[model samples]
Target chain A: MIRVDHLTKKFGSFTAAGDISLALARGESLALWGSNGAGKTTIIRCVLGLLSFEGTISVGGRDIARDGKRARSLIGYVPQELAFYDDLRVWEAVTLFARLKGVARVDLDATLDHVGIPDQGGKRIRELSGGMKQRLALAIALLGDPPLLVLDEVTASLDVCGRAELVALLGRLSGQGRSLLFASHRADEVTSLAQRVLMLEKGRVNAEVPVNQFVAKLGAGSVLHLHMPAPSRALAMELLRGHGFAPTLNGVGILVPVPATQKAVPLRLLAEARLSVDDFELLSPRDASLGQENHA
Target chain B: MSATALETREAVEAHAPGMISNVLTLAWRELRDALRARSFLLYSLAFLALGLGVSYVSAASTGSLGLSGFGRTTAGLINIVLLVVPLMALSTGAGAIAGDRERGMLLFLLAQPVSRLEVVLGKYLGLAGALVACITLGLGACSLVLALQGGATEPRTMLWLAGLSILLALSMLSVGVLVSALARRASVAVGTGVFLWLALVFVSDLGIMAGTLAMRLPVKSLFLATLCNPLQAFKMWALHSIDASIDVLGPAGLYAMDTYHDALPWMFGASLIGWIVVPLLLAVVVFSKRSPV
Candidate 1:
């Protein structure tokens, strides 16, 4: 759905992205993974025709630099930061983008339902929670049903539940044969929605790995830190270890790494063992720094 | 092509809206946003108050509640209009792109299948619509006040003032958009706008005098300077149309009247129109270059 070759972007003396090239097939999902300032957003911007670079980018078939308007017509983009007219109601915002994209009014109703914000049609944008606003952005992006979905850290600002729900929605969209090219640092988001992960470091692509190998080789996922009493911590660690988990005892918690989808497995095991925990925090994979290691 | 493939291709082509439709959609949204803004309400009320207050105070000074004509009433209102209207236009137009760019809204808006030229034209048209409405409200209220005071009021002078105010507003708006396009930060854009308002309204003549003294500049150059400032051009046009005399504008006015004679008004009109068109065209060029698309 999208092809990029020799894409190098520079700002004066500094290069933001260097000679990056990648392509995604019609029904494929690809991710650009990196930390802050790793040039993921820069690559996405180049593909979206929002930057002048020394290379070529094409969406579907149109050259982005030569035919940007028509090239962009094939993409539904969701930016990382949410921006809207605060006074506009949900329906009005949808209608505005709909009209701009030549979307019929009948489909707007269906899009709202598709994004799970049908009841929020009348509420002003400022009245919505961050999650609902993100959903509204998604709905706006989904308009015209563009063949390609280009997202830049879309769930970064969303809470846990909101992030999961949006990931699931995107997963469904991918299943329906939509091409997704997203940039994300969060492993759960990357693992949940992307089929192939492109690891980016300081404007260079270090490696491109399939999702499963990405998981096995890097243990790239969120880590659950369960805080409990000192006595309970030791017992919890031992029990978790027996259940195929490598739980370690920290100062006041047992750290367990698990696949993003199975985050509840350790908690379920603890519950079955009648173990009570005081509290827990899940450290997102973005903080893990595993992707920063050079693969040679 | 297969039947289904042909149908899909046709659907894709139809999905891209024309430039006019995109511009209008964007313009309507800008207008709606302006209407709902607190500043718009405040600006309207300020205009109404300025209009009514000026008329009432002018009438009372004449030792009667009733005024004779639009001449004196509008003569009193012109200075305030010159002071307030440009500032209002500057404040509104300076935020057109900088504010959106800061909030990341500009990128999102440009991500759609629309061109940057269309965005600039749409925003300019929408803001022009808003400024026209405000100026009309103020001038209309001032005329109504004169009519209510029970006298033979001349409607033509008020029409001239309305036309002049709209032109002035548009001219200042064009400059503001140009500033917004050039400045990277919103605060910088706003500061530049206010600085422009001050230079045009208060400092243009004083600076001209200072320059003339320091460099011994000729009167012709000074006249050109006065005409260059849109605010000065607007004032000359307003005063000449209302009182039918350019002598009140002092030497520059007298010099222009003597030099240009019957063509002076058209010259002022042309200057105002030039101010309106030049900055806007420059802004379009700058914006198209500045933005990625």
Candidate 2:
């Protein structure tokens, strides 16, 4: 429900985001992947009408530049840096934002409940942990029940469990026909959570690919290491067949190059072959190239 | 009911607070915060006490100078209010917008549906309200002391002084808000506002005096130059209200020198009002165009 076209944001002489174009549809989850200072935040700020940019941003069919109030009304935003008045209580902060968004007083409690902060309504903001504060930020963003939500680095400082919880919440929200655009540097988190991924480098989209396809292409050439009971070179040779790799057996270990697609196939076949395998493990290729690509 | 009527009814029910209500709400919060701020309250009270003490001392010492005690006391009190009140107003107003920007609260406020004009006007009124309250307390004390010493404290004079005080407050408040919009930091805004106040009140008069002395110009010209300064207008207005005989700037005062002295006050008042309006309009324009950094 959001569309951005030729969006360029420049600060002084530097081009932060140049000629970026993208669209997000209802019930779709898209991740904006980029390194630090890659214009992800700049793009989101342009959509929120928090910055002046050379482009058109439309939210839910309304142009943000011409009709910002209506556009903002249809969009929810979770800023990268969580900022709120520390003196306000959790519920008070949420309620204040709700009121600002034109939500009725009666719906405030229900909104807080929906964000899983019902019991935290009376606690001060300073008393909350990082994860709880992040949840509070989400609650504030969701105050008006906007149709589209833009979260910048939604899982930045959270522990594994908290990140999982947020990802699950986003998935559920998408299931309810809400559109989401999440920006993050965490590959595994984005890969697991978003349906489509937009990888950015230096303020430009480097690759836009489906998550499964990205995983398959990025997951090529895994190493299959086998630990047998004895020097069983024959078992290793048969296991390496059809994967275009000859097995090298040394002592009790066997090494093979198995294509990522044949990972499960060889493992299942070996188990069914009744070979006395003490231990076996499949290791994917080291992602040093992915790191270099991100830096580039 | 038909579907159109039903939708209209729902739309009416879902409407938020109007413009006036929103401004009033924000203004109320600002006033509350000002009242709760210990430093502001203490500084205002201290200034008031100091002003009253000066008025008392001036009234008591006037008999030795062959002047009427009551008139001298009333004049002293008026002068203090006129001179010191604008400085207070300017200091408070200068930081309103800049301070909010520094604290990063302006973005949160601007993100709402309210227009930038509403925000500026609300803040202007709020800070002005607090300044007026402080001025009233100081004026009331001066009035009590004047009454205790059998001074002629006319209601009209007091009313004129109050009006002039408000005018000065509005003028300075507008300038301060403008400076706040222009400056990069709150500290810079406040510093520049104080510097502007001093320049108008003290430095301009000094410069006029020095030029008059060096050029051998008539004292009347020197007096007329004071009118160029806004603070001088406020001073002349207060002096005129207290006593018609005493000519602080003489007949050549800026107010008198203006060919339209009769119309100038109205013009000056309009100009002051414009001062409040123009910068605020510019601020709204700038703020709307500005990206939150």
Which prediction has the highest DockQ against the true structure? 1
TM-score of chain A of each: 0.82, 0.76
lDDT of 1 at B202: 82
Root-mean-square deviation of candidate 1 = 5.3
Residue pairs whose backbone atoms clash in candidate 2: B227-B254
Model 1 chain A lDDT-worst window of ten: A287-296
Expressed as tens digits, the lDDT of each residue in B18-64 for candidate 1 is 88998998888887777777887797788779888997676556544
Which ten residues in a row are the worst by lDDT in model 1 chain B?
A: B2-11
lDDT of 1 by residue, A1-296 (tens): 77787889988888889999898888899999989888999999888888788887777766778767877888999988668677788888888888888776646567789988888888989999888888888888888888889999998898889889989988888888889999999977888888999999999898899988766545646788787878777788889889888876656567788874577899998989888988887765564233222221
lDDT of 2 by residue, A1-296 (tens): 76788889898999989888887877788888888988887888788777888877776666667656656766677765566556668776776566556777636567667766677888888888777777778877776667778888877888899888877776676677778888888767677678888778788888888888766655577667677766455865766564557566544466665665665565566677776667777655453333224445
Using TM-score as the measure, which candidate wins? Answer: 1
lDDT for A179 (candidate 2): 83
